[model samples]
Target chain A: MTVMSRNDLLLFLGFTVVVLAMPIWLHPFGAAYPDLLQRFMIYGIFAVGFNILFGLTGYLSFGHAAFFGVGSYAAVWSFKLLSLDAIPAMIFAIVISGLFALIIGYVSLRRSGIYFSILTLAFAQMSYNLAYSVLTPITNGETGLQLTLNDPRYLDRAMFEAAPGQPVPTLLGQSLGGFAGFYFCAGFLILAFFIAQRITSSPFGMMLKGIKSNQTRMNYTGFNTKPYTLAAFVISGMYAGLAGALLAVTDPLAGAERMQWTASGEVVLMTILGGAGTLVGPVIGAWLIKYFENIFSAINENILHRFFDFLPDGVDNVLVAISSKFVGEGWFLTLGLVFVLIVVFLPGGIMEGVRRIAHLFDRSRRSPTKPGKATPHPQPAE
Target chain B: MFEVIFLQFLNGLDKGAAYALIALGLTLVFGTLGVVNFAHGALFMLGAFCAVMFRQLLTLETVTLDPEKLSPWGAPLEIREPLVQAWFGDFGAVLVNYSVPASIIITIPIMLLVGIALERGIIKHFYKRPHAEQILVTFGLAIVAQEVIKSFFGPNPIPQPMPTDLRGAADIGAFLGMQANVITYPIWRLIYFLFSFVIIGGVFAFLQFTTFGMVVRAGMADRETVGLLGINIDRRFTIMFGLAAVVAGLAGVMYTPLLPPNYHIGMDFLVLSFVVVVVGGMGSLPGAVAAGFLLGILQSFASMTQVKALIPGIDQIIIYLVAVVILLVLPRGLFGRRGVMEA
Candidate 1:
């Protein structure tokens, strides 16, 4: 086997360190709490997988939340049927959601573009609607599936004495809760990043990129392109499932709402906002949004009042009144404005902005004679 | 059984009319301008809010402090009078009742201006951009529009009651020479159905019988050739977008009584209307109208107790199921043209 390239080795090490140090580094932003921290990792994993399909293969599936929801349900079901072990639950989540993704990906890949999007959307909505109503027997309906006191839990019951109180998932007696769970998810996030990077650098990843840039040209060159696209879809769907499993692992509950189209759209926004098709861009995007949701949204009218008290009374009131609409309950309004600004001004998202600034700095700091060395680092799809 | 089926069919047509109206405007934009408008539903919402605002205007009340009278708690008495009713007397009372329908006059100009402003401000710049960029920008615009409305209306649904005279059900069976009162349906719902037809017919007539529409149709068929002929087709497409917004707005105005208007109503309808457009065939006007009624009727029927007993929550996903099946089997939708909405 070929040795890992020097740049790839450096990127892997850098990404792992950043993820491992999230709890420490995010302290000043007031987002260092374990639950929120776990969410950042989980959604980071989700957005990265989504970038594989949307950013890499360029197939916009609007129903990835279906797999995510399926993963959660499978995990919870495993907890109820087998044991309170994270392994079995995650395994169940991945395999079951993988099967679901395979089936959905096969059918959806039959048609391309917006039609593919519509088909996936239809399938996911069907899953959500059925899970909410008719499939109540399995999903437990609107209340969502949760660990029950009288669950069989054959493995745990047989292997060891059952613990009392609200049971939590464990890794061979070590509880996967709070910071432990965050680390568990962080490990998976690093693994997911590694897999994504390797895929991007592989020949198969190049084939997927080929389809994205020009499917017709690829087809003219005699590539079927179906298997590659389908593989990417299922891989991304499995990633979504893994993220969903992590959600269940942390919280031990799964609701049909997780599979809603809006949830799927959230991942899309993260990818686009971060920089689709880039290695670290989606992770950054996910962290930024989660930080906004947790930290920025905490700024209520009282905080705004205190912050603006230094100005003239009239000016202070006016500023607070305007700023109030972009925070707290109005955070979504700000989210909307951000979306507009990002799409209009930064089509390549935050990563593009970063690239441009970096390019300018590189140009200024170094001599202009080495022009080839300063070729702007380009995203695969772009 | 016949009466039940007939009633469900009418319900379907009522729903179908709404679907048709919204999808019509969407398809018009897609067909002529080749832009996927995620904000079309917002236009529908704006129209509904127009009626709400107009009613609020007419029902404006003035408060007076009555010094001559005092409450039991010793506070001054207060008197409230609706300004319009006080000014116009009985005529104003009738006018307030009919305000929902009367607001159509204002909804037109307001929606037209909104439509033109949006097209000119945002969509015009995105003509040559990728479909993903178009969808994202418009989706963002939709959120902005929804947020603006929520800011003004406070996110709760504002119910607009129909004219008091149209509150009761009509004896449609008797009108059809069948047994009296056997097939009763709501009067306002029937009016909405008819009003939808009037609007649809008006849009069709406008497009089919006018010189301007001919040019617009020509532009839709071949933009380059028409542009080569020195006819400014871009201006016509801009007006077409405005015209689409007007159609969607009028649909929303007439629909207020059936379902109350909320800030989120547009989003709720957004996906369903997109499904309708896709099912009808992308960029096909007649197909959109036809598919709207088809899906509407099918949806109502799927909700029947018998149907539900057979297929369990089929009613919840019948539209999506049909779309999936149709797309898999037909691919181009019910009225697809070559190279439209395809990858």
Candidate 2:
């Protein structure tokens, strides 16, 4: 392992502390609000995994939802057949999602660029359609698979009690605790983040980067790039699966909507909107988007009127009219504008903007002389 | 059983025309500009709205007064004239009665302008971006466009009826001495099929015959070389993008009467058309058309009781099944050129 400077070590410790403290710090807010923080963390984990494949390897798998949906179904099924313990259910979900990814990524990775995207999209839509119709017995179709209170849970069945008319055990016979769910989700997200960090720094991750930059160069160097890319694809898919398992653990249901192409597109947007190649960027991106979707969407006209009551009548009406387009039914329009602006202006995403700001401050504080010309600091900080 | 099969086959062709038209436009854009225009479906929706606009225009009258009102003694009541006359006159005008044909004529220029504006306004900026960005921006544009249309047209499928002459089904099966209902295909559907074939032919012939097309084909192969030759290929590509938009729009206009035009009809068709493009081999026009019809027929057949008995929900997935099988077998799609996506 490489030695790190004091500042670097402190930064690492700082990030770790934040990750560990998030659930506890946000617990009060999360408790009052219900599952907002938990959902963000889960989707953040999902986006991080997606970024590994798309941001690193440049192979955008539009069928990622297939893995996600599969993972959820697998997790729920494990609770039904094997145990209600989160560990085994999560393991089953990851393994199944990884297996599904292996098959889909194997086929899709054969093509490159738009064709590859289309192929994966086709596969995802197929999964969605099949789950809605053909695979109803396993997937439970449009109604989605729900936990039954009466299930013969091989483990922890005695610990759980059935609610009246409930078909499945609820949260291992304990009352549904908000803080517990938040912590559980936060723990998994931290684990996923660490895994993603480790993977991006590993030799296999380097190989994937090489494939992204120039596959022909890798081929010339006598490395078979397909298997490496495919492996990355599957691993990332498994990470997505883990996120899916976490979702099911939090919510205890799986629906066909999870497998839709729109869901796949959502992840891609998160990855890109954050810095695709940056480790923490996707997490931030996911959190921001989820927050917008949850919070901004809840503000109705009455709430707006209450907030702006001090203003005069005509001006207040005008303000409401203008602000209405930024929320409620017009949120998607604003979202589209945001996406376009991001893509057109900040190609490297929010992280790039952060990097530029950091550099600007660093440049202003430093000596006037160019570093490479007169000083030992030959490189501007990466 | 045979009658049912024959009916489905006709139904398949009607659907196939739509697939073929959209796929044709997509392929043209892909072939020339190397862009997979995800917003093609939105453009199709816009085209349908154009037809709706025309329909509204033709139906508009300031005051449609009735002169049949009478007093107690049966004296006829006087009626005031309408403030504004019918725009296209009445049933005596061919264009007023025959809306489909009229829509086609109007939609072509309208679609052409829309295509040009879209190419210049938005898609032009994305020319150098990655395919993912292209997809994202176009997808965003699609949502915005659809929302705009929805705001204007409302969230409903606006039905436009075919001409009375073409309202009933053709009696081809009866003339052929088969069961009377064997091939009772609608005349409008047949008109759409013929229109599709004509447009497809015209698009192909234009690309195949024109000098401008020669340059485009050259550019698609090696853009840098074509640029070095001082051809200014981007302009041609922009035009090609517009042409592609027109193609999608025209498809939407003709298709409005067959199936009512809705805001999301484009999105519903987007996935299927992209599938057709891939099955036809990316950037291959003939491949798109062939794959469109092939998948259309397969889908129709899959919906049959015979196929559904074997594989339940096969109809919903037949296109994907065929896509998977084709990809497995051919790898680069059915007609994809070698080295296109070999990596």
Candidate 3:
């Protein structure tokens, strides 16, 4: 890893402060709760890892949630046997998911384009199906894996007399429930952001970018692209694993649903929705999505009526009736519509929209005093 | 043993027909438009909804309240009569009974308009974009389509019954001069299989005989050359997309009797059909149809108790498993052409 420059350090610092102060800033949006905040951090981590593979390499592995689910299952098993501490769980999750990715990636990397996507999707779906039936001894089938009484947590037993109340996850005897868990997840999110930042700048990252742009050209140039892609795949898989483990660490339950294609699609959407290939975009996208999922789903018919109360009775009823289709139970409709609009009009997603706005501001600042002057086109730094 | 095998084969045929129908349309679009349409499944679901809408329309009744006769806890005695029955009597009843088949009339035009509009509206712009963007936009469109269906239909599976005459099981054994009760199967499923064959045969014959299909096939072979020949290949491709949509819709319309459709049915079928398409080899019409049936029957056989005992949950993921092996072994797919989206 290369040394972080001043700009990189500043960006990291800003990200950290913003994440840490989310509880305060997010209060207005009514999403300051630890669960939703923890989700923002967890999915942010997932999307960041996803960005490293997708944004850099342009290998859209549709089966990433397999690793995420494996991570969660690994974490829960670690809690079942090793320790209730999140550190060991995270470690176990990352290592297991990394290996899982290595095998899947080795085979899947042989193919490219849609075939690669399908290959990954097939593997993940297989894993999910297996977890539900054949692997039920470990996965507990549809019931999912959860911490139960009489589990042998030898490490915790060695240190303490009995498990803590509520069987909450801990960090070296410090309780990690509630806001503490949020911070723990936030810490990993920041770390993930930093690592992603470092990788995005590294030479290896450039190789991945080259592979994304044109693998044939790189191949003709005599560079072995497989190992580079495989490495990125493993690293991103590890990130997904860590995110999954964190999900289990906070909730202490793992389900097969996490391995489903929809879960993988969610991460992909988060990455694209934020603007793939751009640092902080996936995180921002993940945050915005989580916020809307939490807040918009909570908007019931009563809330819509309240929102539309300012209009006349007839108009209010009509407006509320129409708007009601895109909120509450229909929140997914809003998400789909927004995502479609974003992909259609703004292919670069939220990041591109932000860039255009920023560019406009910059252009206005430069050409304010002049009329009909050609604005200098400079390459915008991603 | 023979009975079990034959029954599973029939089951597979039933499933394969549906899969082949869906995959056929998918491959058609992929071959013609060169776009990965994730919304193809949504088109299938919309076709199913057309059936639902047709039935609802047929059964729509007029209600009148009579002040002379009031019911208990009622303002007035209400009388309800089906408007179709009142208008056409016996024919109206027959129309109601055969709504599933009749829905094809509405589904064709609707799906065509949808496919053409979709091609012209969203997909036309995406032709120059990356495959990732194409997938994302279509995937987004799919989600929107399903959600809109959910909002309108309220996320519940709406069952469409097979026609009354086709409701009971047919004694296939008797037809084949075996035991009377042996090898019995539902009449509707058999009809569905035949319907799919007719549709598939029609498509192939159309392509084989028609001048239009020849030109379209030529365009599929080489779009640039066909364009240089002073032919409007793009418009034909757009029409091909509409034809694909009609195939998907008709499949959906017929499939309602087998599996009640909710908003999510399209997605469920979409994944399996993609597997079929890939296994059959992308852009190969015959391959899609063959793979759909092969996988479908294999899936049915895998669900047998003996098979399940040997390999638990194999039935649940047989298609994906087959897809993975095929993709790894034969990168171009089973019957995939040399360079049809192979890169």
Candidate 4:
């Protein structure tokens, strides 16, 4: 495979620089407020990792949250036992989560297709349930694992001395509730994005795509497909772990809800919505959905009544009733509709949509080309 | 210990009945149509709603009884001729004071129509799609179904009381003299258990004895071959889907008296039923039944205080835990037909 093009490299660098500068850029408009952008990026990182498995392998895992939750739990545990250095905590988190994924993947990957999906889902639910009860000491039961005053962080514990009777201690000098947590999460997301991008362009990624397209051909061609798939699965798990660690780092807690199967399904939705096979698609998808969730959920009837004041009272009431079904408790309805539309109309996702637009412009530019001569379109960089 | 074991065993059987019924419908659809009916749970909820509607028919209410010519009690009780008179007039009027059996007679046709409409309206469009897309759409449909039910049922469990004759508990332990309170199983649950057995038996017998059943079985095994032999496979498959829906609905209907029916009731059971179907080996009928009972028993055993003392929270995950172990050990499931899941 050829190296990435100079233009693409520039674009990647440009994107990374912008992401690094997001907090400052988003400050004025309060876009960075509520840590919303950071969440988009963190979930984007999680979705990108998830896409590597589902999008590449066509084996939809419905239990990725198990890894995510494991990562969070591991990181929280690290903070409780080891020093509060983010590096060590992150490393321990990813390693533990990857190890858990390795075992789960081994058993689950034995069955392919929907069976695999269900197995992962069941495992995730089992883990979530176990965490809520049997693993209460570690998971802290329904209350979840948080940084307590009792946690001995040796080196930087002084930074997090909560006032007496203030309950749980904050991480470093910041609660999971502020700008520092957002930046910390966004930084990891950028790194994860670059790694995911590299992996997709690598030979290993091609093998996974090959496995998706035709496992029989790969088998007959002398490749032991299990190790390749398992490797991909482990890498994906590590990414999930990193995302989870970042979530805990920002939020300073790990709850059983993090491991629920619905969380796993959300990742699948994010990956697909963004454009599964495309590197940037999952990020965009994650951002789009998270945006709707945080923004749309707040648009209540009072807001609607104020906005549509020009309409007659009766008509406005009807409109509000209709619109409410597409938002709020009915958010899934809108999400499901969008999912169906994308699946039916845009099978390749938003990236495909982008490519089509580019192709259209390219065609118009080549309208005056000489007969029997092909107007050049850029070759796909390896 | 014996008493505990016996009670747990009965508990397993109760839960097993629900699992087996849901699995049976799923298996029927999978076996015959080559489509996984993911909305089976919705159909089950619809059945419970049917039971609720049936029970509402016989409920007698006194509206302060026109007391113009009353004695010392001051009010004469008078029942309103329910609003059913404005709608079905004759049919609705007849149903106002009828017994549950009469109401059930009315419900079967309504449930059947609902089953057919659901299959033809939404599920038909998904038959040719990939399993993921099918799952998504059905998942979407299930959400819509549940939401619609919530709108109608007010987002709460609708209590459907059993007929007066079936209200008390049965004392099976008294016959054995183990203890006076050894087995005081609820009468409604027992009736539900018996009802499920009868329906299951009837279904099996119908499939086993009839020519139509033979053709459907043959079609299930090899649709192309059946089609080549001039059978209308699509029509039969559609019928089978409808039949599966009805079966699910009937199970839900009978199960309502045991537990109150709710909008989200279907989803609570869907995940477990899917596991049962998988553990039973995809499309295997007997496997679904056996796995359903096995998982049910394991779940009950896990929920026991003794088991909880050992594992802390075995009850919450016992079914899934058992499913994972079973899948790992027997990938094709306990009674999986060879080559069914060769891929």
RMSD of each: 3.5, 4.7, 3.0, 5.2
Model 1 bad stretches (over 4 Å): A367-382
Cα lDDT tens digits for candidate 3, B130-248: 88899999999999999999999889999998789889999998899888898999999999999999999999998889999999999889999999999999999999999999999
TM-score of each: 0.97, 0.89, 0.97, 0.87
Among residues 3 or more apart in sequence or in different chains, the pairs in candidate 1 whose N, CA or C atoms overlap within 3 Å are none
Q: What proportion of the real contacts between chains A and B does each prediction keep?
A: 0.70, 0.58, 0.81, 0.49
Q: List ranges where model 4 is wrong by over 4 Å.
A: A1-3, A7-11, A17-32, A155-177, A357-382, B1-3, B50-118, B151-154, B174-181
Candidate 3 to truth, TM: 0.97
Assess each prediction's global lDDT (C-alpha) against the native.
0.91, 0.81, 0.92, 0.79
Ranking 1 against 3 by DockQ, winner: 3
Compose the digit string of candidate 2's lDDT tens values, residues A180-249.
7766777788778767776777788898899889988999999999888888888899988988888888
What is residue A99's positional error in candidate 3, in angstroms? 1.1
Better of 3 and 4 by lDDT: 3
For residues B1-343, write the lDDT of model 2, one tens digit per residue: 7777777877788688789889988888877776668899998889888889888766654543355888567766555432223343454256656766787778888888888888888778877777888888788788778767765687888999888788898887998898676577788888888889998899878878999888888888898999999999989988888888888989898898878988888988988999898888887788999888888877888888888999888898889878877876777677888766454
Computed on C-alpha atoms, the DockQ of candidate 2 is: 0.56
lDDT, candidate 4, residue B198? 84
- Which parts of model 2 are misplaced by more than 4 Å? A1-12, A19-32, A156-176, A302-323, A367-382, B1-6, B56-101, B175-179, B221-230
Clashing pairs in 3: none
Ranking of all candidate structures by their lDDT, best first: 3, 1, 2, 4
The candidate 1 chain A region of ten consecutive residues with least summed lDDT is A373-382
Indicate which candidate wins on lDDT: 3
Please give, for residues A1-382, the per-residue lDDT of candidate 4 as tens digits: 4688686687679878877777777677456674687687789889989988888877888899999999999988887777555677789999999999999999888888768878998988899989998889889999889877767666555665435542332455445456766667777887887777777778888999999889989999999899988888888999899899888776678999999876887888788778887888998899888878876667777887787889998999999888876666666667766776776567677889999999998876775565235545644567
lDDT score for candidate 4 against the true structure: 0.79
Predicted candidate 4 versus true structure: per-residue lDDT over B145-178, tens digit per residue? 7766765566778776566667788887897786
